[model samples]
Target: MTPGARIAAAIDILDAITAGAAAEQALTQWARRSRFAGAKDRAAVRDHVFDALRRWRSAGAAGGGQSGRAVMIGLLREDGTDPAQLFTGERHAPEPLSHDEAQVPEPTPARGVRWNLPDWLLPEFAESLGAHAEATAQALQSRAPVTLRVNLRKASRAEAQDALQAEGILCAPNPLCATALTVTEGARRVKQSAPFAQGWIELQDAASQAVVAALPSGARCLDYCAGGGGKALAMAADGRTTFAHDIDAGRMKDLPSRAQRAGAAIRLLDRAGLEQERPFDVVLCDAPCSGSGAWRRAPHGKWTLTPERLAELTAVQDSILDTAKDLVGAGGHLVYATCSVLRRENEDRIAAFLAGHNGWFCRLEQRFDIQQHGDGFFTAHLTRVKL
Candidate 1:
């Protein structure tokens, strides 16, 4: 498909999203119908849709409206591209811009609009991130880097890098963690690559890898809120007797296969199983949150999150910590983590947990800010207070 055709496809998908369809759902529907579109065409169209979503407010303001066409126009303007190029009236292209659409509006002074975030989130971002809030918001407007964590249990970082490079997947060492490799090229081929098939690497954010790397020494570890078991797998690779449990056991249906592929042993536990395997040396609670740090990968989340939802998430975080604490053995560590940049979900939650749990005290706390290398993350290590 022509570049113009891709833009037209993106406009249609964005329109569906604006009409309440999920971005992924709309994109999938379009793809299923447009069998003639090639892989690159579909990828290009998806990129355009996500790019516009990431800058929804600013794009709408610049284009003078919130329609798909207007937002596309605004997105192009923000990117320093002339909308006329892609909106040409040629076959398969978007309709030509009207005179009003062609006029570029001045940039908005409102921080929320300028930062491409909801108005309600501005104060939260400011309070959570301080001077870095605007920069962090700007970072979310672009695509996230493709990072991989070398399965040290299978291969050294250098060995994994060599294997990935052999498959044309260029990579550079990520500074966030010794095991991390930032995919510099050929990211689309990673899943099909031999190294990945052999479990030499797993797709994970560098910061996420760092969170696992910072874990204290322990013979047994339990990922208390293990969703897909990414951290569980990582911890298992460290040679710890790792166990994974989630409230929804269905979320870990594929974990056994994943663990097998990575040559890591992770015992999956239901509530009853968890009770039997209690008193672990370390317990990691990677709680769910607003996912603000990962908005670059899931831009729709930023738009969909509400104050009520955030409050609910914080409550859940607190409850998870409370429950997970009892499973830690004497002198064992309880780790709390989240992939949110908001303090309300990170430091504030830790404070609340410590306040309510008298025998626990925090030992270490770290915040990984959103950058070109990785998403924002927070981790805190807590242990029982000795009398």
Candidate 2:
């Protein structure tokens, strides 16, 4: 397909999203219907749609409307590209911009519009991030880096790098974690690479890998909220006997296969099984949140999150911390973590947990800010106050 054709496709998908269809659902439906579109065409269209979603507010303001065409025009303007190039009246291209659409509006001075976030979230971001809020919001407007964690049990980071390079997938060491590699090129081919097929690497953010690397010494570890078991696999690779449990057991259905591929042993547990396997040396609660830090990968989340939903998530985080702490044995460590930059989900939750639980005290706390290389993350280590 021509570049114009891709932009037209993106406009249609974005329109569906504006009409309440999920971004992924709209993209998938379009792909299924447009059998003539090639892989490159599909990828390009998807990128355009996500870029528009990431800058929804700013794009709407610049284009003077919220329609898909207007958003595309605004997005192009923001990127310094003339909308005329892609909105040409050629076959398979979007309709030519209207006279009004052609006139770019004056820049919006509202921080929420400038930051490409909802108006309600400005105070939350400021409260959570202070001086770094605007920069972090800007970072979410771009693409996230593709990163992989080397399975040290299968190959050293150097050996994994060599194997990936042999397959034409270029990567460089990520500074955030010793085991992480930021994919510099051929990111689309990573899943098909021999090293990945052989379990030498797993797709994970560098900040997520660093959370595991910072874990204290422990013989047994339980990932208390182990959705998909990424951290569980990392813990097992670090030479700990790892166990994984989630309230929804179905979330762990693929964990056994993933564990096998990584040559790591992770025992999956239901509520009953978790009770039987209690008293772990370390318990890691990577609880759910609004996912603000990694919005680059899931931009729709930033738009969909509401104050009520955020309150629900905070309650869940607190409950998970309360429950997981009891499973830690004497002198054991209980670690709380989230992929959110909001203080309500990170520092505030920790403070509430410590206030309610008398015998526990925090030992270490770290925050990974959103960067060109890694997602934002927070982790805190807590230990019992032995009298």
Candidate 3:
């Protein structure tokens, strides 16, 4: 497909999303109907649509209207692309820009549009981030850097880096975590890389890896809220005997396969299984929350969260911690972690845990900010001293 044609496809997908269809659903429907579009064409079209979504408000403003054509115009204007040259009404290309559409407006900035976030979140960002708020907010406006965790059990960092590079994927050591590599180029080819196929590397944020890296090592470990088993897999690579448990067993269906590929033993446990595997030396809860720090990777989540939903999420985080605490034995460690930058979810929640539970002592508090080459993340270690 031509450049103009890809922009046209993106417009249709954006319209579908604005009409209440999910982004992925709209993309999939478009792909299914247009089997003639090659793999590269489909991927490029998808990228354009997501870029527009990431800056939806700014796109609408620049385009002068919220219609499909307007968004494409806005996107082109934002890129300083000539709409008349691209949209010449050629085959598969978008229609020609009308006389009014040809006049691209000067790039004026609004606070929310500048931040690439909703209006309600600006104050929250300021409160949570202080002086670094603007930089962090600006960071979320663009695509996030992709990082991969080199599985030590399978290959050394040097070896994995070489393998990935041979596949046309460039990576450099990420400073946030020793085990992580920031993909500088060719990230689009990572999945097909031999290192990834052989399970020598797994896609993980540098901050996420650092959170697990800071944990106290133990042979017996439990990931209490092991959603999709990312942390569990990380733990397995750290040479721990890991057990993963989530309330919803359906979420862990592919974990066994993933672990098999990694050649690691991560037992998936249901509620009953967790009860049976009582008293692990370490219990880790990477709880669910607003995911504010991860908006760069999953921008749609930022738009969907509300104050009420956050309240509900905090309640669930508390319950998960309460349930996980009992699974730790005497002299064991209970670690709480969240990918949220909000104080209410991080420091405040840990403070409440310490206040509510006597005889527990805080051991370590580790926070990786958004500028740390990955998403912002917080983790605290609390050990049962008196028990």
Worst 10 residues of 2 by lDDT: 378-387
Residue range 1-387, candidate 2, lDDT tens digits? 988889889889999988999889999999999999998889899999999999999999998999888888888888999999988879799889888778879998999998999989999999999999999999999999999999999999999999999999999999999999999999999999999888899999999999999998999999999998999999999999999999988999988998898999999988888889988999999999999989999999999999999999999999998888889988889999999999999999989998888888899999999997799999999997656
The sequence of per-residue lDDT tens digits that candidate 3 reaches over residues 274-371 is 88888898999999989888877777777677888988988888787777888888888999999998877888888888888887888998777887
Per-residue C-alpha lDDT of model 1 across residues 271-371, encoded as one tens digit per residue: 89988999999999999889999999999999989999999999999899989998998889999999999999999998998888888889999999999
Supply every candidate's count of residue pairs whose N, Cα or C atoms clash at under 3 angstroms.
0, 0, 0
RMSD of each: 1.1, 1.0, 1.8
Off by over 4 Å in 1: none
Which stretch of 10 consecutive residues in model 1 shows the poorest summed lDDT?
378-387
- The C-alpha local distance difference test score for the whole of candidate 1 amounts to 0.92
lDDT for residue 232 in candidate 2, whole number 0-100: 94
Q: Which residue segments of model 2 deviate by more than 4 Å?
A: none
lDDT of each: 0.92, 0.93, 0.85
TM per model? Answer: 0.98, 0.98, 0.94
Candidate closer to the true structure by TM-score (higher is better), 1 or 3? 1
